[model samples]
Target: MKVFVLGTGGWGIALAMLLHHNGHAVTSWTFFQEECDLLHRERANEKLLPGVRIPEGITVTTDMSGAAEADLVVMAVPSFAVASTAEQLSRIVPAGTVIVNVGKGLDSQHGYCRFSETIDRAMGGRNPVVALTGPTHAEEVARGVPTAIVAASASRAAAELTQAAFMNDTFFRVYTSSDLVGCELGGAFKNIIALGAGISDGLGLGDNSKAAFMTRGLTEIARLGVTLGAKQETFAGLSGVGDLIVTCCSMHSRNRRAGILIGQGKTAQEAMQEVGATVEGYYATEAGYRLAQQQGVSMPITEAMYEVLYNGLSAKEAIRMLLGRPRRGEHEEVWFH
Candidate 1:
C-alpha cells in the first residue's frame, strides 16, 4: 500500500513509522521546510517522537503533491488544521483514495463538525473519510507499546480497509465501527473532561473526587453525543470512557497537564504557554460549550470548563457553580436509535 501521512507531528510520525514497518510505501508531510529537511536528513522526528528512529523507507516532505498517487492518505495533523489539510489533500489525492483522520477534536470553525464530516465537506464528498481514535498516545505508540484503537466510518468498507492497513498483533490493534459520530464525539469530548480532571489533580483533590468527576463527565459526553446523532453505547467503548480514563489520569496527557497548571493559580494563557504543546482540550472546551448551547444539551461539566477556560471564572468558582446545580435523576437513559 502507498500511504501518505499529512502532518509530521508525533502522531503522524508514529503512524508513518508503523505503516513503514508493515511493508507499506510511506511518505509523510511537515508544514515547514526546516522540519521536513530535518526528518529527511536525520530520519528521526526528534522534537516530537524522540528516541524512535524514522524508518529509512519512509519519505518525509513538505509537498502536498506527495499525496497524489497514494492509496491512502492519513490526516494526523492537530484538529485545528484538519480542514486546511483536507482541502489540500482534496486537490492532490487521486479519486477514490481513502482518507483516515487520526486527529481528535471537533472542528470549532465548522460548528463542531466531526473530522469525518469536516474532511468530507472540505473535499466535497469526493473521498471516503474515516476517523481513527482511542486511548492511544503517540509517545507510547511510537515506542511500539501495545495500544488498541477504533477506525470509524459511515462506510464500513473504508473502516475495514483502515483496520487491515494498520492493525498489528503485538503492539497495535484496530477495531471497526459504523458509528463515526459517536467515535469522533467520544474522542473530542473526553479531552474537555480530561482538562477538568487535571484541574482536580492540581487542586489537591483526591481519587474520590476525580473518579466522581470522570463518571459524570462520561455521562455529559454521552448526552451531548446522543443529542448529536451518535449511538449511546459507543460512549462505553474505546473512544469514550476508555480514552477518557487514560487522558484524565495519564502523565502523557497534555490536556490534563495544562489543566493542572490552570488549577494551581495559573491563568489559562500561562498554563498553555507552560505546556508548550497543542492542548486539544482547551480548544474542545469552548467548542463543546457552544455545541451544548446550540444543541440544547445539558453539559454542565463542559459548560463549567468553558467558563474556566474562557470567561475568567476561576476553577473553584466553576466547581461551586456545578455543585449548586439542581439535583436530577442519576439514571435517565439517553438512547439514540
Candidate 2:
C-alpha cells in the first residue's frame, strides 16, 4: 500500500517508519519546508524522537499532492491542524480514500467534535474515516516497543483494512472496533486526566492520591462518554483506561509533563513554553469542560482541570475543590440503587 502520513511530528515520523518497515511505499508530509528539509537531509528528528532514525526508503516532503496517490492517508497532525489538513486532502485525495486519524483530541473549533467527525466533515463526507488510537506513545513506539492499539470505525471493513495495513507480528499490534465514538472519546479524555495526575506528581502527592485521581478521572471520562452516545464497555478497553494509565504515568506524555510544571508553580503558558511541544491536554481540558457542560454530564476532574488551566484556579485549590465535593458513593448508579 502507498501510505501518506500527513504530519512530521514524532508520532507521524514513527508511524511512517513503521509503515515503511511493513513494506508499504511511504511518504510523509509536513507543512513547513524547514521540517521537510530537516527530515530529508538528516533522516532523523532528534528533538522529537531522539535516536530513532527515519529510513531512507520513506519520502518526506512539503507537498500535499503526494497524498492524492496514497492508498491510505494517516492523519498524524496535531488536533489543531486536523481540519485544515483534512480540507487540503479533500481537494486532493479521491472520494472513498481511507483516512486513519492518529491524532487524538476533540475539535475545539467544531463544538469539540471527535477528530474522525471533524475530518469527515472537512472532506464533505467523501472519505471513510477511521480512528486509530490507544495507549501507544510515540517515544516507545518509535523504538519498536511492543504495544497494542485499536482501529475504530463505524464501517467494519474500513476498520479491518486499517488493521491489516498497520499490524505486524513483532512490535506493533492492531485491533479493530465498531465503537468509533468510544475510541475517540477515550483517546481525547485521557489526556485531561493525565494532567491531573501530573499535577499530583508535581505536588509530591504519593501513589494513593494519584491512584484516586486516576480512578475518579476515569469515572468522569466514562460519564461524559456514555452521555455522548459511547458504549460503557468501551471505556474498559485499550483506548480508555489503558490510554489513561500510560499517558498519566509516562514521562513521555507532554500533557503530564506540562501538568507537573504547572503543579510546581509555573503557569500553564509557562509550562507549555518550557515543554516546547504541543501540550494537547491544555486544549482538551477546555473542550472536555465545555462538552460536559453542554451535555450536563458530571466530570469533576475535567472541571477542576478547566479551572486550573484556564480560570486561574491554583492546582492545590483544584485538588481541594475535588476532595471537598459533597460526599458520594463510588458509583452513582450504586448509590441510587
Candidate 3:
C-alpha cells in the first residue's frame, strides 16, 4: 500500500513508522517547511518520540501534493485541525482515495461534529471516511509494544482495507466495526474521564478511588453516547473501556498529566502550558458537556470536568460534589430493557 499520513505529530509519525515497517510505501507530511527539513535531516522526531528511528522507507515532506496519489491517506492531525486538513486534502487527493482519521475529538467549533462528519463536510462528500481509533498510544506503538485498535466505517470495504494495511501479528492488531459514531464517541469522551482519574491521583487518592472514577465515568460516557445514536455495546469495546483504562492509568496520557497539574493547584490553561501538547480532553470536556445538555443526557462527571476546566472549581470540591449526589441503583439507566 502507498500510504500518506497528513500531520507529523507524534501519532502521525508513529503511524508512518508502523506502515513503513509493514512493507508499505509511506510518506508523512508536516505543517511547516522547517519541521519537514528537520525531520528529513534528523530522521527522528526527537521532541515527540525520542530515540525512535524513522525507517529508511518512509518519506517526509511538507507538500500535500506528495500524498495526492497514495492508496490510503491517514489524517493524523489533532481534532481541531481535522476540518482544515480535510479541506486541504480535498483539493489534493482524488475523489476515490480512502481517508482514515485517527483524531478523536468532536469539532468544538461546529456543533461538535464528529471527525468523519467534519471530513465529509470539508471534502464535500467525495471520499470514504474510516475512523481508526482505540487504546493504542503513539509512545507504545512507536516502540513496537503490543497494541490493538479498531477500524470503523460505514463502508465495510474501507474498514477491511484499513485493517489489512496496519494490522500486524506481533505488536499491532486491528478490528473492524460499522459503528463509527460509537467508536468516535468512545475515543473522544474517555479523555474527560482520564482527566478526572488524574485528579484523583493528584489528590493522593488510592486505586480504589480511581477504579470507581473510571467505572462511573464510563456510565456518563455511555449515557450521552446512546442519546446521540451510538450503539451501547460499543462503549464496552476496545475504543471504550480499553481506551479509558489506558488513558486513566498510563504515564503517557496528556489528559491525565494535565489533570494532575490542575489538581495540584494549576488552572486548566496553566496545566496545558506545562504539558506542552494538545490535551484533547480539555476541548472535549466543553464539547461533551454541551452535547449532553443539548441531548438531555445527565453526564455528572463531564459536568464536574467542565467546572474544573472552565468554571474555576477546585478538584477537591468537584469530587465532593460528585460523591454528594443522591444514591441510586448502580444499574439504573445503564441497560435498556
Candidate 4:
C-alpha cells in the first residue's frame, strides 16, 4: 500500500516509519520547506522525536500533490490543522480514499465536532474518515515499543482496512470500533483530565489526590460523551480511560507537562510557551467547556480547567474549587436500598 502522511510532526514521522516497516511505500508531507529540508537532509526529527531515525525508504516533501496517489492518507497534523489539511486534500486525493486521523482533539472551529466529521465535511463526504487513536504516544510508538490503538469509523470496512494497514503482532496492535463518536471523544476529552493530573503533580499532591482527580475527571468526560450520543462502554476502552491514564502519567505528554508548569505558578500561556510544543489540552479545555455548557452536562473538572486556562483563575484556586464542590455519590446512577 502507498501511504501518504499529511504532517511532519513527531506522530506523523513515527507513523511513516511504522508503515514503511510494514512494507508500504510511505510519503510524508509538510507545509514548510525548512522542515522538509531538515527531514530530507537529516533523516530524523531530532527535536520532536529524538533518537529515532527516519528510514531512506520514506519520502519527505512539502508538496501536497503526492497525496493524490496514496492508497491511504493519514491526517497526522494537529487537531487545529485538520480542517485546512482536509480542504487541501479534497482537491488532491481521489474520492473513496481512506483517511486515517491519528490526532486526538475536537474541532473547536466546528462546534467541537470530531475530527472525522470535520474532515468529512471538508471533503464534501467524498472520503471515508477513520480515527486511529488510543493511549499510544509518538515517542514510544516511534521506538517500536509495544502499543495498542483503535481504528474507528462509521463504516466497518474503513476501520478494518485501517486495522490491516497498521496492525502487527509484535510491537503495534490495532483494534476496530464502529463507535467513532465514542472513540474520538474519549481520545480528545482525556487530555483535559491529564492536565489536571499534571497540575496535581506540580502542586506536590500525593497519589491519593491524583487518583481521585483522575477518577472524577473521567466521570466528567463520560457524562459529556454520553450526552453527545457516545456509548457509555466506550469510556472504559483504550481510547478513554486507557488514554487518560497514560497521558496523565507519562513524561512524554505535553499536556501534562504544561499543566505542571501552570500548577507551579506560571500562566497557561507561559506554560505553553515554555513547553515549546502544542499542548493540546489547552485547546481541548476551552472547547470542552463550551461543549459541556451547550449540552447541559456536569463536567466540574472541565469547568475548573476552563477557569484556570481562560478565566484568569489561579491553578491553586481551581483545585480548591474542585475540592469544595458539594459532595455527591460516586456513581450518580447508583442507589442505596
Candidate 5:
C-alpha cells in the first residue's frame, strides 16, 4: 500500500517511519518547505525528533496534491491545523480516500472533535474519516517499541482497512472499532486527566493522589462520554484507559509537564510556553467543561481542571476545592453497582 502522511510534526515523521518499515511506500507532506528540505537533505527532523534520522525509504514532499492522491492520506497535523489542512487537501482527496485522523483534542474555536465533523464537511461528506489513537507516544512508537492502538471509524470495513494498512510484526498492533465518536472521545478526554496527574506530581502529592485523581477523572470521562452518546466501554479501552496510563505516568507527556508546571506555581500560559510544544490538554479541559454543561453531566474533576486552566485557579486551590466537596459512593453512577 502507498500511504501519504500530512504534516511535519514528530507524529507525522514517526508514522511515516512506522509505515515504511511495515513494507508500504510512504510519502510524507508538510506545508513547511524547510522541513521537507531537512528530511531530504539530512534525513532528520532536527526540531521535532532530533538524532533520529528519517529512514531512506520514506519520501518527503511539500506538494499537497502529491500526498492527496495516495491510497490513503493520514492527517498527522496538529488539532488547530487539521481543518485548514483538510480543506487544502479537499481539492484533491480522491473519492473514498480513507482520511485517518491522528490528532487528538477538541477544536476550541468551533467546539468539535479534531478533524471529526470538520473533515466530513471538508470532503463534502463523501470520504471515510478514521481516527487512529491510543496511549502510544510518538517518540516511543518511532523507536519501534510495542504499541497497540484502536482505529475507529463509522464504517467497520474502513476501520479494518486502516488496521490492515498499519499493522506490522515488530512493534505496532492495530485494533478496529466502528464506534467513531466513542473512540474519539476516549482519545480527547484522557489528556485532561494527564494534565491533572501532572499537577499532582508538581504539587509533590503522593502516589495516592495521582492514583485517585486518574481513577476518578476516568469516571468524569465516562459520565460525559455516555451523555454525549459514546459507548461506555470505550472509555475503558486503549484510547481511554490505556492512553491515560501512559500519558499520566510518562515523562514524554507534554500535557502532564504543563500541568506539573502549573501545579508548581506557573500560570497555564507560562507552562505552555515552557513546554514549547502543542500541549493539547489546556484547550481540551476547556472544551470538556462546556461539553459537560451542554450534556448535563456532572464532572467535578473536569470542572476543577477548567478552573485551573481558564479561571486561573491554582493547583493547590483546585485540590482543596475537590476535597471540600461532598463525597459519594464510588460506583454510584458507574455500572456494576
Candidate 6:
C-alpha cells in the first residue's frame, strides 16, 4: 500500500515512519519548502520531527498534485488548520480516495467537532471521511512505542480498510468504530479535562486531588457530549479515559504544562509563550465552556477554566469561585439514554 501523509509535523512524520516501517510505501508532503528540501537533500525533517532519520524509499514533496495518487492519505495537522488544509486537499485528491483525520476539537465559532459534517461539505466530491483518535502521543509514536487508536467511518468497510493498512503487530493498533460521534467527542473533550487536572497539579495538589478532579471533569464532559448525541460507553474507551489519564498527568503534555504555569500565577499569555507550542487545551476549554452553556450543563471546571483563560479572573480567584459553588449530590448518574 502506498500512503501519503498530508502534513510533515510531528504526528505526520511519526505516522509516515510507522506506515513505512510496516512495509508500506510512504511519502510525506510538506507545505513548507525548507522542510521538503531538508527531507529530500539532508534525509531529515529537522524543523518538525527533528533528530529522527527517515528510512530509505520514503519521498517528500511540496507538490500536492504529486501525492494525489496515493492509495491512502492521512491528515495529522492541528485542528485549527484542518479546514483550510482539507479544502486545499479536496481540490487535488481524487474522488473515492480514503480521507482520514486525527485532529481533535470543536470549532469555536460553529461548535461542531472539527471535520464533523464540514469535511464532507468541503470535499468537492469525495467519499465518506474517516476519523482516527486515541491516547497516543506523537513523541512516543516516533520512538515506535505500542499504541492503539480507533478508526471511524460511516462505511464500516472504509474503517476496516484503514485498520488493516495502519495497524501493526507490536507498535501500532487500529480498531474500527461506526460511532463517529463518540470517537470525535471523546477525542476533543478529554483535553478539557486535562486542563483541569493540570490546574490541580499547579496548585500543589497531590494525585488524590488530581484524580478526583479528573473524574468530576469527565462527568461534565460526558454530560455535554451525551446531550449532543454521543454514546456513554465511548467515555470508557481509549479516546476518553485512557487519553485523559495520560494527558492530565504527563510532562509530555504541553496542554497540562501550560495550565500549570497559569495556575502558578503566570498570566495566560506568559504561560502560553513559555509553553511555546500548540497547547490545544486553551482553545478547547473555551469551546467546551461555550458548548456547556449551550447544552445547559453545569461544568464547574470548564466554567472556572473559561474564567481564568478568557474572562480575566485570576487563576486563584477562579479556583476560589469553583470551591464556592453550592455542593450537590456527587453521584447523580446523568445517563441520557
TM-scores, each model vs. reference:
0.96, 0.98, 0.97, 0.98, 0.96, 0.93
Query: Which tens-of-lDDT digit does each residue in 203-269 have in candidate 2?
Result: 9899999999998899889899988899998889999999999999999999999989998999999
User: What's the distance in Å from true for residue 169, model 5?
Assistant: 1.8
Candidate 5's C-alpha runs over 4 A off are 333-337
Q: Poorest 10 consecutive residues of model 3 by lDDT?
A: 328-337
Task: Write down the lDDT of every candidate, Cα atoms only.
Answer: 0.90, 0.91, 0.92, 0.91, 0.87, 0.81
The per-prediction CA RMSD against the true structure, in angstroms, equals 2.6, 1.3, 1.9, 1.1, 1.9, 2.7
Tens digits of lDDT, candidate 1, 237-309: 9999999989999988999999899889898899999999999998888888888899899999998998889
Segments in model 6 whose C-alpha atoms lie over 4 Å from true places = 45-50, 109-111, 333-337
- For residue 9, model 4's alpha carbon misses the true position, in angstroms, by 0.5
Pick the winner on TM-score between candidates 3 and 6: 3
Candidate 6, run of 10 with poorest lDDT:
109-118
Report the poorest 10 consecutive residues by lDDT, candidate 4.
Answer: 327-336
TM-score, predicted candidate 2 vs. hidden true structure: 0.98
Expressed as tens digits, the lDDT of each residue in 5-42 for candidate 3 is 99989999999999988999999988999998988889
Of models 5 and 6, which has the larger lDDT? 5
Candidate 2 overall lDDT versus native: 0.91
Clash pairs for candidate 4: none
User: What is the Cα-based lDDT of residue 109 in candidate 2?
Assistant: 86
